[model samples]
Target: MLLPLPAQAAALDGSQLSLLWGVPFAGILLSIAIWPLIAPMVWHHHFGKIAAAWALAFVLPFTVVYGLSATAHGLVHALVAEYIPFILLLTALFTVSGGIYIRGNLHGSPLLNTGILAAGAMLASFMGTTGASMLLIRPLIRANDNRKHNVHVIVFFIFIVSNIGGSLTPLGDPPLFLGFLKGVTFFWTAGHIIWDTLFLVGTLLVIFYLLDRFLYAKEGVQRQDDPTPDTVKFGFNGGRNFVLLAAIIALVLMSGLWRSGISFDIYGTELTLQALVRDIGLIAVIIASLVITPYSVHEDNQFGWEPMKEVAKLFAGIFLTIIPVIAMLQAGTNGPFGAVVRAVTNADGSPNPAMYFWATGLLSSFLDNAPTYLVFFNTAGGDAVHLMGPMASTLAAISAGAVFMGANTYIGNAPNLMVKAIAEDRGVKMPSFFGYMAWSAGILLPLFVVVTLLFFR
Candidate 1:
């Protein structure tokens, strides 16, 4: 059910601006009216601050560029809804995976901990970065619970498990799936696997080596007596929720399969199966995930709906307040932005993949990565160039950038907020909004610069 990047190739033709602005705005208004019921969750300390910051980030720029740009309203909604189920699956994965149950000794040799980290990274590639992160984060915290200098461990977890490890497959991340739908062969993405995996493994080996060297020296300074022998059993008080998560993923796959068929003829050009999937899958997944997952999951595990409610409050504020501004940009702002994109042509007047990679990635860090990826993909139609190899390669790089670097911040990807919420649910105090950026700016930005120099460049 993965969508192709080329399937998203539609120009920024403005229509339905009123409805685009209105729906998200109304969703926001309704959310606020329900705030009293959502108070306990939305008002939590961690999310409350994040909600405020998210509001400011979306609002300030929206106000400044309200009438100066234009966008494709349908594209934005299509992109948003397309990945909503994936987001819920990630949320469900973290919520049920014993959220943060960890058992182990921090006194283990540095070599042993590194081994465990590598295992976590491998799991990330299969189950997804967010799922791996959520499942392992609590255990990582618990492993280092007895130690004071554990921040480095957490940082490296984000680096490998959350970002780098998922470079090989569509199941690993949404952006890679974009490439899959775009006619790139299923295993084509695995071409980058060697470099990406090496980079992650090498980086973690070095970082964790240095960290353990320092932290080990400090061990004696605050050492405590070892606990009683044979007491390492860990328990999940909320272990029965795996069924809920399974149901969510099943529904997501079902919706994806179902929507892959809904299509129509347009101007004598029949829509491809890929296009049909992207367009219809979005609506199908959103409706199904929202209505079905919540009800089914609620039956068994009745956690105070705190996490989802918090996300709803913040995202509602974001979608509502920025609609008019986004609508205006979509209506008439194509010349400057589109010119930059449209002007960079191949020797034969085709699109430039490197430019697409950088542009989509840079904006994706701020705007929704999904739409940003679609905008660039649609603009660079296959007909723009008759040659196949270069075009496909270019699209691959763009897809990687959008999906991989999106882990750089709490808001860069939808799963990011979900990870943070689940982390908090396990009692791990994740960084503040800007504090998270500080983490990304240090680790992920450097990694991205390396990727730019090595691959995208």
Candidate 2:
């Protein structure tokens, strides 16, 4: 077992940190947004290095100013408390889901495509956004490979399956899971936000169906030669991985529900026994997937580690660079982002649900939504009981914002980027980082406004 650091070596005080400390985080985001568009080859080859450079840019300067011990503590806390668990769960999901290959192709009629999206939306809550996206994206792409105008299909898939669909259950998204770990009841989100989810999902589905119908009509009956003809009967391969997927879900649920009251302190970070068991269990699941999955399944699915690698490397830097940014936000009114914290409150000091919705959402668009949800959850007084009771609307707003608006940008959620990477790898010609934002701004922003008026207000 690891020994704890002295109590004096606690986390960095965001109240004392200057705004300049956020430069590296902004730099990384800009690099992600611009570099790929301007210089695709360089960005692809050296993106990890670029991410690492930005991370070092923050760490090196921070170490000099705050002393090595403080910087070390911060880094340890960020990794031990946040990043490692995050990547492990993602890895397990990616491996297990990637192993399951849906054989044969179904033509992507507008109605059929809409039905698949609807099914994926339902699956996302149970299997996780990452798992559901990986499981369904390949089949969706295969189904639509012949379509002339299919980009909208993929974009809407990201919006519906990978983000908004995950809103109803903690098992669906990271932010909600974090909320669960913080003592929110298991079904609280479903009970509170079911209507909001139904409205957004139902509306998006109708819009997708209509748009796809229009595009399908414009492209004529046969848009392009079907790259994947429906020659074989439709079926699933790697069926055992489904069992592993269930095990993954069980591990996650067990971690949240089982209280061992045992933990270790690595530097200043607390590592709980249930979390340790969950991580170890996930590792076992990943190994089991790779070992038991048939080689033919992997081949037919065209499954590769590149998408997972891209997500892991990029997020390593994001989680690292975001350290001081989270701290500053956590500092509340005293921090540089005091305006953001203040926007969620009224003059009489009651939480403003609409402002909470927008504030949590806009920031979650660029920043990591999980921690952003935590910041706002605490900002609304951190008592889950009170938030779930008198402040139920506020909690609901924060939850909805973090989970739903994650589709606004590619990097807003881990699965979004992974889906983009996989789609592009399969020759989908997906939109660029900013290009995706244009789609979201046009479609989702208007819907979000309606959501704010109808629900948050």
Candidate 3:
């Protein structure tokens, strides 16, 4: 559910919004970043409360300052409109994909892991990052469970499948889908960003293979306590779920294509008929997947709702606290964040596409990429025709930046964290937030620098 801003209401006047309004948003993000490292036990226990406190820190004072109606408008807009739709979509994907158990006793050799990652990267463009990651991660994890040095495989999986792999189409990732809704053609992203995707994704895959080959040699082959050691035949356990995955894709596509114009007004938020239909369809998909999937399939997959629950709780607060920050960004040059806008622009006022790439990427690395892309998209004049025409480079930069750089951190995109949580739950000791950043800084940043020169420049 997206809150439709009336033509009259440009959301909030950026000039009137102060830097003060943005502190809680910063607080929540910082807590998400630093707290998990210094206080893992407390963070795991009371993260939801931390998220809620930050949300209330903004909402309570905002109500006092702007009046109850304005506060209600803001909260309802973030909660009922954006957050619910986000969580439900993730839940539906996680639930359905978890039922799909890719059963096989394939060795977790360098070649096998690379092949699985490559397959997942291709599947991501059709089934979405969340769907593709969930479907393949379990098998990948199981394959590597017997190995000593396997965390690198998960890291590269995040780099490729969870992030870069989703660049080809709107269904692959949220930022691209937001662009689609803003009137960019369905194939526009793939047409413009395919080269970037190919280069970055291909480079990452090659790097992973060489690195894994080195690590495999260093660790040596040890099958002493092998879980599924013998080379059993490969087969999928829940084939029917493929149909459900296709239906999810079709339903998402329908939401974008259908334009009935019917809408409901909740507080100040407006929910469109198509969006309402999409959410309802997603709920139906979740229910159907649960009912149709056998209990054993889930048990074998080791499926649980903890990952989904964590994402929902954390992002619920993130969406709310982000409201003011986005509003401030919308304020542009007159607002507190004016310098950021200035940095991305030339002295003559045309957008620097390269700067747009880094700026969008950096923000998307921490903040939600979908909204970050929307902000920069609108900032670059918000006209699909112009963007696809003379401003084509600008739009492409924003699009690529949002999608590609999300792999920079676990919290960068929704599915990145989901993959991390799921991997940790399955007993893989994933890196801490900063530790993960070390991996990206070493492996991904150098690749991005090359990308900046080849594409954005």
Clashes of each: 10, 0, 0
**Candidate 1 runs further than 4 Å off:** 1-109, 178-186, 192-194, 221-230, 234-336, 340-353, 382-389, 414-439
CA lDDT of each candidate?
0.53, 0.86, 0.83
Candidate that scores best on lDDT: 2
Q: Comparing candidate 1 with candidate 3, which one achieves the higher lDDT?
A: 3
Please give each candidate's TM-score.
0.61, 0.89, 0.88
Candidate 3 ranges with C-alpha deviation above 4 Å: 1-10, 146-148, 177-185, 214-227, 231-233, 265-268, 366-390, 414-435
Model 2: per-residue Cα lDDT over 1-457, one tens digit each: 5566574466768899999998988788777766866898998899899999999999999989988888888888778777787778778877888899888888899999999999999988877898899889998998998988999999999999999998887778989877876678778999999999999999999999999999999988573478776679999999999899889878987887788988898877788999899989989999999999999898877778876787678778877887888788768788887887778889887889999999889988987687678778867766889989999999999999999999999878878987898899988999978899999999999999999999988
Give the per-residue lDDT of model 1 (tens digit) for 1-457: 3233333323333343333333443344334334423573654455455545545554455445442222233325423533333344444444544232334334434675687678777766555665566556655555555555555666566666776676666556656554444444445566744475567467766778777867867675333543323255654433334444455444434433444553433322234454444445444433443443444333423334555555555554554344443334334224223354454446566666667666767766755565455555555542213213556656666666676666676556655665566556645566876788897788677777776677756
Candidate 3 lDDT for residue 187: 79
Number of the candidate with higher TM-score, 1 or 2: 2
* Leading candidate by TM-score: 2
Off by over 4 Å in 2: 1-8, 178-186, 214-227, 366-390, 421-438
**What lDDT does model 3 reach?**
0.83
TM-score of 2: 0.89
